[model samples]
Structures are given as C-alpha cells and as structure tokens.
Target: MTTGLLNKSTSLDMKHLTVFIYLLLSFSTPLALASEKKNILVFFIDDLRPELGCYGQDYINSPNIDALASDGVLFNRAYCQQAICAPSRASMMAGQHPDTLGIYDLTSPLRRTIPDSMTMPRYFFENGYETLSFGKVYHHHTDDREYWTDLPDVPGELYANPRSLESIALLKTQAKTRGVKGVALGRAARGPAFEAADVEDDAYRDCAVANQAINALQRSKDKLFFMCVGFAKPHLPFSAPQRYWDLYRREQFIVPERKLPQGAPLLAFTSWGELRLYQGIPQEGPLSDEQTQELMHGYAACVSFADAQVGKVMAELDRLGLRDNTIVVLWGDHGYKLGEYGLWCKHTNLELDTRVPLILSAPGFAKGERTEALVEMVDVFPTLVKLTGGDIPESCEGTSLEPVLKDPGEATRPYALSQYPRGTKMGYSLRTDGWRYTEWVNIENKKIIARELYDHRDSQESSRNLVELPEYADLVSTLSKQLDTHQRTAARKVKAGQ
Candidate 1:
C-alpha cells in the first residue's frame, strides 16, 4: 500500500512539471523574438531617377544597386508625394501627404508645421532603437534633433573639394560686385554647374557619408540601430571625382528629346529656372546641344559615383555579418528631368520627375523578385514598422506594404498620387494601371485651371495630352472621379489623424 501511494505522488509531480514547461515556453517565445529585432539601414539618394541597370537602363553602370535589387524586391513604380526635396522628404519621413505637412517649399521647417508628428526615426528611437543620421535625411534644420542619437556634422563649406569651394567664393564675390539682391544673390553664389576633379571620393560630401555609415555599422552590433546615410550626388551642380567622369565618354551621351507634349497647356511646363541658377547654364534660354550633352554626362557620372559609395557601406554590412538581420532600403528622394520636356530639375508633376527608385531587402523574404505595384513614398514608414514588429500608429497616413513584400504578385493600392506647386496653383496628378491624370487647381479659390491625361499603354513619354479630346471625355470623367475620391479619402484620414 505504501508503494502504490508513492507511485501516485510521482505521477502527479510529473504532470505538474509538464504544465510548468509549457507555461515557460509560452512566455519565453516573445522574449526571444524581441531580442532578435532586426536592424534598419536606409540609403537616401538625391535627384536619382529610375535610370539604373536594375531599372532597365543598360547604359548606366550602377552595379552596386543592381546587385542589391537582385537580392531583394525592386519596385518598378514607386513615387514621391512631391517632386521637390524638402516637401517630399518631410512627407515620406512623416508618413503623411504634403498637404497634411504643409511643406511645399525648401525653406519650410517640418517641425513648424507638425510639431507632434512622429517621424520614422523618432518612432524607432522611442521603441528602443538607436537612430543615427549621416547626411541630408531631413533637409538641414528641418530635422528634429531630439529624435537622432547622432546628427550629421556640418561641413565648413558647401562643397568638400577645395577647388569647388574657391569657385563658390569667387561667385559670391562676383555677385556682391554686381549688387544682386534677394533670390538672385543666393543664385549667384552657386558654384559651377558641374565639376570633375582628379581627387578621391572623400573629396565629396557623399563619400564622407558612406565612411561614417561604415563606422556606425561596426559599432552598433550589440544593439538595434536605424541608420540613414543620405548621398548628395547626382543632384544639381553635378560634382564628382574625375574617375567617375572617365567611366563615360561625353560624346556617347545623348540629350533626351526636348519635345513638349502636344495639346498640353503651357502651365504644364516650366522655364527650368532651377537649372538657370547655376553658373555655366544660360540665364534665360534653351541650352546648346553641346551643353545639354555635357550636363547629361555629368549627371551620369555622379550617379555612378554615388553607386560606388553605396557599395562601400553595403560591403561593411556583409563583413560584419549583419546582412541576415538587417533590412537595407535604397531610395531616391525624387526623379530628375534630365533635359526631358525642356526641363532640368524636378519641379513638375511628370513621370520623369515623380517616379523614384525604391528597393528593399530583408531577412526571410523572397530574393531577386521585382514588383510593379503602385507604391508611394509615404508607404515606407508603416512598412518598416510592420517589419520590425512595431505597432502601426493611427497617425500614419500610409498603407503598410507588408503584403507586397511577401508576395511580389500582390497589389496593395490601386493608384499612386503625386503633386507639385507652381506659384499659386497646385498640380495634383494620379497614376493608375492604365493612365495618368493631372488637374491643376488654384490654391486660393480651388478652381480647376487645367487638366492633362496620358495613356501609358500608348506611350510612356506622355507625348500628348488626351483630356481635351471629345472621344476620351468619358475616360477623363472616370479618372477625374477616382482622383477626387482619393483626395477626399486622404484629407479625411489626415483630419482623423489616421
């Protein structure tokens, strides 16, 4: 009888132990997941269009970015909220539309408009990650200093090369001699339109940015980090090392066709005042063929130079064995005109100006896949949050692209929107599967000033506007309704703080 009683007691003890083990695993699983949180690295390039090899440009030598696309999802159709720098950066970082941010110009501070908005880096920092910014991530003073653990070190001069610095100083002296005031004074101070110096990559600001990123990666192995390395190449004043310039022949460069869209309103085009601000460019007129070709060559050389810098930072990530646990995103602020439509900069609501290059690589996702889903810059914030196992805040106006990341065939949104302001008018453009529709509205009175419609199935160059044609009236009506619906929905979400 004593033996039987002992056996019963032992069985009961074994059952209790089994229950305890089960409870322990249930609690420990979450802790393990939390400890393995993935790190994030963002490469933000300035004025880069989808002209890389990965984006089907065989002429451009963008091997680094092409390899990255091979190991990740390359988005074929990704657009920014606006074509300009400051407003586009603010909108994407805040995960809100430009209308909500109230930043249409380069001078407006993001915090002045939305003081309480949680920026992408700020959200990550608040969630126990160390956030670091190396270059032009938030447009200078617009960056909220409190969110970053490390901010960029301001350089003594605008250009890293001594020659370029001297050129700028000379320009300033000339401007003072001429007594140019206000906006013209600032424009006069700009250095050469393009520069090719026989110096190392460190002679430019972008190379320094890459070096800083490499060092940060080496030190942040023990903790999760959100690092943003912004490269300022391929933008205006296309200054790059002579080695990059040697990669291409100026004679081989071809200037894009400068044909204006047929039947399109004059309001759709600009005088390209941005390009005229440079020293070598004509103050007011079309550039000569030789000048256009030179500019194109300079732009291409700068792109390849930026690509090399990207390669350096990526190599460091792999060497440190952080490739598996780190998510790397390479994106451009917006596209450049590149002499298209007689324009030089990104101030219009055209495809060449609005469509940006976006690539994302992460652990456990499919490799060498490309998606043609219509996505916007705003979607990046929520997508990162979802990947990092963070809560998607209600204030985020973008939809999470998690589904598209998992399956390339999936469609997240039906359309993508982009807008740009010209004087007192705002051009709101929409891109759908088959067509692009744009409506220019008077900001003060909300009256429609002009309309443009381009059929992508017919031509990608947007050679002609079909909105005025009588046969396409029904099609225009349908697209206009869709645009209105999207705008209303976005406004509502912004007001509701969604």
Candidate 2:
C-alpha cells in the first residue's frame, strides 16, 4: 500500500512539470517576437501630387520613388482631409479629420484645440518604440514636441545657394520698405520663381535629412525605431540642384490650362494669394506662358531632387540589412496645383489639390501592387499600428488599410472627404468612386450657401459644376445624402471619443 501511494505522487508531479514547461515556452515565444518588432520609416514629402512615373506620369524623373512604388503598394486615389498644408498634415498625424481637430487654418496648433489628443508618434512612443523626427514632419512650429523622444531637427532655410539666398534677402528688404499692407498685396519685390544652383545634394536641406535618418537607422539597430523624414522641396519657390534641373528640358514642360470652370461658383476659386507671395510672380494676373513653363520645370526638378533623397535613405536601409524587417511608408502632405485651372497652389477642394502620393512597403506583402481604392490620409495611423503590432488609440478616426495591403483588390472605404474654409463659409467636398460633390456651408447657421457637383464619368476635368443640370438633380440629391451620412458618422465618432 505505501509503494502504490508513492508511485501516484510521482506521476502527479511529472504532469505538473510538463504543464509549467509548456506555458513557459508559449509566453517566451511571444516575447521573442515582440523584441524583434519591425522598424518603421515614414518618408513624408510636401506638395507632391501623384505625377510620378509609377503613377503614369513618365515626364517626371522620379526613378527612386517609382522603384519604391514597385516594391510596395501604391494608392492612386488617396485624398487628404484638407488641401492646405497645416490642416492636412494635422489631420494625417492625428488620424482624425480637420473638423474633428477643429483646425482649419495654418496658425493654430492641434494640441491647442485638442489638448489631450494622442498623436500617432506619441502612441508609438508609449509602445516602447524609439521615435525620431527630421525636417518638417509637422507644419514648422506647430509640431507636438513632447511626442518625439528627442527634439526634432530644424528644417533649415529655404535655399542653400548663395545667389538664391541673396535674392530672398533682397525681397525681404523690399517687403519691409513696402510695409504689411504692401506685402499682403504682393507689392514686395519678387524673387525668381525657380533656381538651379550648381551645388551638391547636401547643399540643400533634404540631403541633410537623409543623412541624419541613415545615421539613426545605423545606431538603432538593436531597438525598434519610428523615423519620420520630411522633405521640404516641390513646395513654393521650387529650387533644387542644377543637376536635377538639367534632367528636364524647359520645352518638355507644358503649361496647364488656365480656363476657369464654365459654371462653377466664384467661391470655388481662390485669389491665388500663396503664389502671389513668391518673388517674380505677377501680383494680379495670369502667368505668361513662358513664366508658367519655367515654373513647371522648376517644380518637376524639385520633385526629382526629393526623390533622390528618398532613394538614398532607402539604399541605406538595405545596406544596413534592415530592408526586410523595416516597413517604409512614403506620403505627400498634400498635392500642388501647377497652373491647373488658373490655380497655382493647393487651396481648393479640386482633385488636383486633394489627391496625394501614398506608397507603403511592408514585410510579407506582395510587391509592385497598385490599388485604386479611394483612401484618405487619415488612414495612415491605424495602418501603421496594425503593421507594428501596436495598439491604436481609441481616438483614431481613420480605418486600417491592412486588408487592402494584403489584397490590393479589396475595397475598404467608399469615399474620401475634404474640407476648406472660406471666411464664414466652409466648403465640404466628398470624393466617391464615381463622383465628386461639394457643399459650401455658412458656419454661423449651418446653411448651405452653394452647391457644386462634378460627374467623373462624363469628365475628369472638374471644369464644370453639374449641380444645376436638370438631368443630374437626382444624382446630386443622392450624393448629397451620402455626404451627409459621412459627416454624421464622423461627428458621431468624434463624440464617441474617437
């Protein structure tokens, strides 16, 4: 009887030991995987439209960015929440719309409106990732400095060339002499719209950005990193190295059509105030054909210059053996208008201003895939969270694009929404798979002051507003209802603490 009892005790002890060992292995495996979490590289560009070779614009010399598109997924119809720089970038970084953040202009910081808001980088930093920012990730001084693990590097001056710098100094002196009203009216002496300086890549700010990013990658090999490198070219006063400018011939550039939309409301057009602020541009009239061509050439050259910097950073990732494990996302803050419909900058709700360039490259995803699904810039946050195994904050209003990333044919969102403010009235635009609808609403009473609709099937030009057409009234009503539904949904999400 004593021997049988002893044998039973031994058997029970062995079973308990086996269970303990299994549990240990299970927990340990997950820890190992977490320790090896993929690093993130967010390459952000300013004022970039989807005009690269990969996006079917072969005229632009964007080989590096094109190669990135080939290596990942390119979103052809991704739209920003707003066309302006500050509002659009704020929406993207916060994973919420401009309305939700209550930022409609270039002046207010997002935190000032939503003080408790957790930005995407803040969330990642909380998840034990080393976050680094270089250049203009946020709109200059509007950056949430505490979110980054370190102070962001200053996004140096506009031009590095001595001649360009001299021209800017002269313009500033002229502006001072003319006073604030004169400057506002563009009475200041204008500088050249474009400059092709015979300098090295580092002579510009973007190359320095690339170098810093590469160094960060090299040093952070043992830890997971979220590095955001923002390139500041292709904006206004398009300036680049002479090498990039030489890549394109002035004659090869074509001036865009300057005709105002036939039946569009006057509110849909801007005074082109931003362009007028630049030197050498006429303060009140349309640019001459020669001037337009020169400006276009400069813009394309800057794009190429930005692309080359992107290539350098990408090459460094591969050189450090971090390519396979790093997830790279290339995004433009907003699109620019290069003489499109008599507009020269991004301020309208038109497709040329709202549409941007978005590319994502992740491990285990198919390469060289392009998706035409309508997506918004706000979706970037949730997608990165899902990719990095991090928890997305409850305040993120954007949807994750993991499903689309896995299978490019998958349809996620039905439409994208963008808004711009015109004094007391607000223009809310909705871009669906087939149509674009906009309603200008009076802010004080929420009354729709004007209505504009464009039929994509009939024409992609967006040069005609079809709201008053008798045959399209029903279509307009349907789309207006759809837009209302989207707005209501977004409002509800914001109310629900999203």
Where model 2 places Cα greater than 4 Å from the true spot, the runs are: 1-24, 178-190, 458-460, 495-498
Over 4 Å off, model 1: 1-13, 156-163, 181-184, 494-498
Indicate the TM-score of model 2. Answer: 0.93
Give lDDT per model, in order.
0.88, 0.86
Q: How many residue pairs clash in each candidate?
A: 0, 3
lDDT of 2 by residue, 321-431 (tens): 888899999999888888888788889888878889999999988689999888999999999999887777888888899999999998789889999999999999999
Candidates' RMSD to native? 2.2, 3.3
After aligning candidate 1 to the native by TM-score, how far in Å is the CA of 346 from where it should be? 0.7
Candidate 1 has a TM-score of 0.95
